[model samples]
Target: MGLFITFEGPEGSGKSTQARLLYERLQRLGYPVILTREPGGTRIGELIRRILVDLRHTEMAPTTETLLFSAARAQLVSELVRPYLKTGGIVLCDRYADSTFAYQGYGLGRDLEELQSITTVATGGLMPDLTFYLDLDVEMGLQRKRSARDRLPEPASAAAAFTPHPEWNRLDARDLAYHQRVATGFAELMRRDPDRWRCFVANQPVDLLAEQIFTQVEPMLARIVRLENPR
Candidate 1:
């Protein structure tokens, strides 16, 4: 069977960049690899991604957003992930169900069990064999994304009703308390699935981070090769 790998983290944690690097490295090693991202891996999913990320849709409710994300995930898995897995290819996903759990359940205060159920159905129980979670501070991630702030909402008044704040970019909109909760949620998930999840401190340089990931992945790659080429 194919090996499924996923990268998860808060915004600006470099999960996307590292996923691309790993995909390239795996291809260089002659492994059949497929690179894709959640909320976008399929045509319908890409449309959903535009709706989810567009700053103009600032009034979207938390529940609606959560369901939209799950919908996209279901389409992506059924269209892209399942076929690649069936071909014994290494599937490198930029983000997956974990994002919904972190962003919607933990950050947006949705019910965790409900979100888990949605994810289970969306993925058809096809969880990643390995997940590399890049941990970083919310402040740092916000700072990294602040440079391109043209599309984000401004910070809203704390006392007034929840108007769209320009800083309400997906990750930036959350209060520090919520972001901390997300971090704790991810940590808890790691503890709960220690065999499948690996936590990495992503406060390092890109090359160094890649090297650390390679160290963990090399053995897994060897095992994949052994299984594929049993003599």
Candidate 2:
């Protein structure tokens, strides 16, 4: 089977950057790969993303939020991710079921068991073969996010964030405690699955972190390549 990888982290933790760099590196090697993000991959997922991220949706209940994300995940796994993986194509996702565990389950104080049940229904029990978690202090990550937002041509308000990138939604505007819980939750998740989850400090230089990530990914990718075309 093709490699299924996902990146996870707090906001501004550079998950997207590392994922993109790795994707490019794989492409240069002539690997068949597809890079995608959760809550929005297919047409139905994008529409669900609009509701999940819009700042005006402050009235959104935690249950409602979880369900919306699950709905989008169901579509993505069934539509794009599953087919690609079955065909022996690498699929790197920005975020996946883990986010639901971190955000709604841990960050929002929901039941992890219940979340897992929902996630099973969403992704049809598909799990990432490798998950990279960009570790960063909650406050530092938030600061980075704020600074980056401030640098944007458009003002980095709730409205602007949601409009431009749906993932950069009202969550960024949430309370510090909420984000702290997410960071802590991530640690717990990684701890539970040391074999599958690789944690890296996010405060380091991009190239350095990418190198570290590449170090971890290289052997695995090599194995996949070797297995697919055995001598």
Candidate 3:
């Protein structure tokens, strides 16, 4: 299997930016790579993303949100991620199952075990080879998101306009306590699987952070190449 790397973080933590930077760096280095985002990578996933993030969907329940996200994720993995990995091309995802664990399970107070079972079925047990968690203060992250929403025009949909950052969604409007729980949830997740996760303080300069990530990833890719093509 090829490399499967994922980016995870709280709102405004710059995960998407770092993921995009890594994707470009890998491409410039002549690696076969694809960068995709959660809830909206595939055609079907994009449709699901609309419902999950629409600012008007105020009545949507936590369970409903979980199911919608899982549906989109399942479509993405089946149609794009798994197939790409089978071909030995790197797949860089902006988020994955871990988001569900952090957002729905922890932020919204859903059952983690239940979310895990649902996620397994949704993803067919697929997991990332490495996950980058961009850490930032919960309030700072949320504030950044709010500022972006104030400044950036809202795209018609996730796949419509290629904005630098995503428009603020319904989840961005959640209470501070909920977001705090989500941050805590991410911490607990990293603690559970330290080897697979690389946590970075996200407030660093963008170029510096991207270099840090690429430094770690480049060595791993070298190791994989060596193992596959032993002398």
lDDT of 1 at 74: 93
Please list the residue runs of candidate 1 whose C-alpha ends up more than 4 Å from where it truly belongs after superposition. Answer: 148-168, 223-231
- Candidate 2 residue lDDT tens string, 51-132: 8878778899999999999999999999999998888878999999999999998899999999999999888899999999
Whole-model Cα lDDT per candidate?
0.80, 0.87, 0.88
Which residue pairs collide in model 1, if any?
Answer: 152-166, 153-165, 153-166, 153-167, 154-165, 154-166, 154-167
- Candidate 3 residue lDDT tens string, 1-231: 889999999989999899999988887767778999988999999888878887777899888999999999999999999998888888999999999999999998899999999999999999998999999998999888888777966678976543233557778878999999999999999999999999999999999999889987987686333223322
Where is model 3 poorest over a 10-residue stretch in terms of lDDT?
222-231
Models sorted by TM-score, best on top: 2, 3, 1
Write model 1 residue lDDT over 156-191, tens digit each, in one string: 665322433333344466577887888877888888
Model 3 error, position 61 (Å):
1.4
In candidate 3, list every pair of residues with a backbone clash. none
In TM-score terms, candidate 3 sits at 0.91
**What are the models' TM-scores?**
0.85, 0.92, 0.91
